[model samples]
Target: MFRSVLVANRGEIACRIFRTARRMGLRTIAVYSEADANALHVREADEAVLIGPAPARESYLDQARVLTAAKATGAEAIHPGYGFLSENAEFAEAVMAAGLTWIGAPPASIRAMGLKDAAKSLMVEAGVPVTPGYMGKDQSPERLKAEADAIGYPVLIKAVAGGGGKGMRRVDEASAFLDALASCQREAASSFGDDRVLIEKYILSPRHIEVQVFGDAHGEVVHLFERDCSLQRRHQKVIEEAPAPGMDEATRQAVTAAAVRAARAVNYVGAGTIEFIADGTEGLRADRIWFMEMNTRLQVEHPVTEMITGQDLVEWQLRVAAGEPLPLKQDQLSIAGWAMEARLYAEDPANGFLPSIGRLDHFVLPDDIRVDTGVEAGGEVSQFYDPMIAKLIVHEETREAAAQALADACADIEVWPVRTNAGFLVRCLEHQRFAAGDVDTGLIGAEEAALTDARPSDAVIQDASDLLWRSRNVDPNDVWDAEYGAPGFRLNAARVTRQTFFVDGVRHQAPYENNHPVVRYGPQIDGGFVVFHGGDAYAVSRHAPRGAGGGGASDGSLRAPMPGKIVAAPARSGDAVTKGQPIVVLEAMKMEHALVAPFDGVVGEIGVSVGDQVAADAVLAVVASTS
Candidate 1:
């Protein structure tokens, strides 16, 4: 094994790689940008180096800086931990050119699969089933439109160089093709610097099932079963599981064999994933699944596969990079138990899942399951990176047990201020359809109402009120202080101390009286207290007194819902726009959000333009009531 390996990434994946490297007695080096100077991964590494500024282009994605840090730290190998530079073929070659071992697939293999159009062609030649689509090189808009028409409506316009759902749009008709193409192209150029696209038939009932494939320098390849990544939102995976719930032995064998064949086609080495889109309208079958794309590095959901197979994939990567043969043959690998993983992101489901950036006031994870995270209590979640807080993985003897355990863990989280989709995740796992394994890529969208309608129960609200009352009156120095009656209350008369709170935007008042029994609140943190009641926890902080200022703007204003860059301003000042017409496009957290005109009116003062960064609640434009 290499003496020391430098992790050329950030966040949880970096920490995860370091853990495995340390266990193998290999020294680990971490590279960080200014934003991650005090990050947990930096603190955990044996040695750390500052690469560049906070922006990814200046730091994490800068090849020269990463190589310099690795060389300066005397790292014998560099592990690109699944983002940024993980799939960059040029970066892989450059690392090898610098006389450092690259702990990933061969640069040739990466190049082969880097472009979707080319990869699909390669898969077809290798006898792997592929979805019908257009992979032509003609860049004319008319050509793409014609192809879309031939493929029929409801076709997917996908960036040839895109991942993580960026640069993808689904067009339902010819009338919408041009607009979707423009949006997809803009996103593609911004994300991958390549606007080339491919057209594919959008599967109505799609189930994303990917097989984990590994190869060695000795020309040996093996399969590690598969993961069901069907639970998704906005084309991004939210939950994943191993040994797909409805998978049978025959289907598994067929998919795994196809995955190995795909790996061999590229002479692939190290860890890679062959993702397939299955038609689940009927049921999972070998013939119904088709190749979608291949991820050329360790996946984010590798933990679920690890739990079921009892193997450390990172260890395999290290050994293979060190010129070792395959750890085990395909026949020796077997699924042990079912496992599930839920990605907890710092995003608010109530606000259209907008990414939230702030300090973690009271971060806590369940102790019963495995949590892979790079942030801790008091950690700052910066706006320069992905907003995923952690990946919670659970294992059990059965899929139902695993799902229930994962759901409970999500509900048990006690994060404050920073909004999360924890409640939504819990609902997804507990939903009748999900529990029965009738899952698909559209599951979240179909059941969004149940998943996101998380309102604090009355009992929870009452507990919060009581806790707030006690926090103000109870003396911290004296635990038995009984002077905790509501202020200005007499001995016999009933007094009601009304406290107001906003839960999901709606205001609620809970009254507390000195006559009622004191409800114990948890220990106070810096900014808030965590209250538990009726098996649910609520993070409560005293609301700041409202000022005399007017309650925000009227419905005529188009304000930014979150901090982001203004990518487009279609309606200029003095331009008339109809209600629900897109006026501004804000790009944040690698996704675009369109802010529309609230009513039919003429645009007035335009406060922001393209390429301007604005904070949350900043008014982007004003619409005078023309009605």
Candidate 2:
């Protein structure tokens, strides 16, 4: 067995791996960037090393530095905790060549499943059902478009080398195929250094069902059931649960068996995921589900699988790396109950769901649920990494109970200044369709406006108003002076103070009254009270409610949604534009956000060009209104 392990990653997963390693009595080592030097994960490690600066390319993804740190720290094994270099086959081989254990799938397995096109071919040869798509190697734009035509409209163009929802696009018609393909290829080239792509028939009602598979060197592989990650937005998973709802035993058997077959085909070892996309218009069936790709590493949502199966996946990985036999035979393991996990990200849903980065002044997660995070109250969410702050996991006897518990936990979260998607997550979990188990990948997109509602209810307003009134000082001898038009008291009673607050940049006016309601409020920050209602933070502050309220008409300037690099400027100066036409596509935090035209007008000014670095609120273009 290995005596020490170094995690070649950052954030919650690193902390998670350290926990299991410590329990097994293995010395823990953490590698951090300069930005994460004071992170919680570093503090939790027995030994920590600084690899490089803030940018991941220079820090977390620098293979040589990570390997050197492991060697210097006497780490017997390197656990690439899911991201960074986890699935890099060459890096895995390099670790083994350096006479250190690599705690992941074999290099051969990673190479076999590295590309979507090649992996799908492998799955087909393994006698597993794969989605109907094009995996041919002809990279010509015309050939790809023809393939899309044959596959029919509404086809998905996915990068052969993509993961984490990057390098993917959907085209609904033949005319739009080329443009979407160009964007997809550009993203793929930028993200994965591979511009090659494959096309798939877009499942209108799709459900992301992935099975967790573990293999040992002794030729044994077992499935840990399946998880439904269909609740998604922009191809990114938002909520995931174990033992997919409405999954019949027959379908489960078929999917799990196929997943095991896929793993055995590559002679895989350690942990991996076999992702399948199901035609979910009908309930999950053996025939409707097919293989999509294989994630040859641990997933971010592995905790729910752990909760349901009652097993430490990291322990399994360690044992497998040490050439141990399977912990339990296929027949011995079974699901204990239902489990759900919600990713708590530092992002603003109202502001086009842009990543919010700053010092976390008041980071408070619920204690009742199992919360895993890598940042504390005084920590900062840097601009150089993913925005996910924590993960909230819950387990119950049934799926219904688990969903409700997880929703309540999300609502109880209290984060200030740095906005979060807690409110959006709560809506998704508590949605009536979600509760009924009638969900698909488009559920979030279909109900995004309602799910991302940034407004607080009337009751919340009343509660905030009451608190604001109580917190203020009332003068004892102020008379109602009508001549001077001053706000004061009458002879017998006091006039209600007009409580005004600025919420979401809009002024909310209400009378201050003595009424109590169950409302959660965060600590005072920047002279305002943060009212946490239904998972949304309302930064309420006095605005005086004076004059004819503030601003006027629009200037039609489109600004950068967040700090990012402008990848494409589709709209040039003097171009005719519509209200929602795509003007600039900015890539940030490993995802693409399209900044569109504000209203129907002509593009008067183009402030950014392709490859230009931009900051949040930096004007990218201006539209001159015609009407």
Q: Find the candidate with the highest TM-score and give its number.
A: 2
Per-model lDDT: 0.87, 0.88
Q: Which residue window of length 10 is worst by lDDT in model 1? A: 544-553
True-vs-predicted CA distance for residue 432, candidate 2, Å:
0.5
TM-score of 1: 0.92
The reply for model 1, stretches above 4 Å from the true place, is 468-505, 509-554
The superposed Cα distance between candidate 2 and the true structure at residue 491, in angstroms, equals: 6.6
Error of 1 at 487 (Å): 12
Residue 555, model 1: lDDT of: 59
For candidate 2, the lDDT comes to: 0.88
Q: Pairing residues by index, what is the TM-score of model 2?
A: 0.95
**lDDT per residue, candidate 2, 122-212, as tens digits?**
8989999998999998999999999899889899999998998888987889998987888888888877778999999999899999999
Per-prediction count of colliding residue pairs?
0, 0
**Model 1: per-residue Cα lDDT over 251-341, one tens digit each:** 9999999999999999999999999999999899999999999999999999999999999999999999999998899889899989999
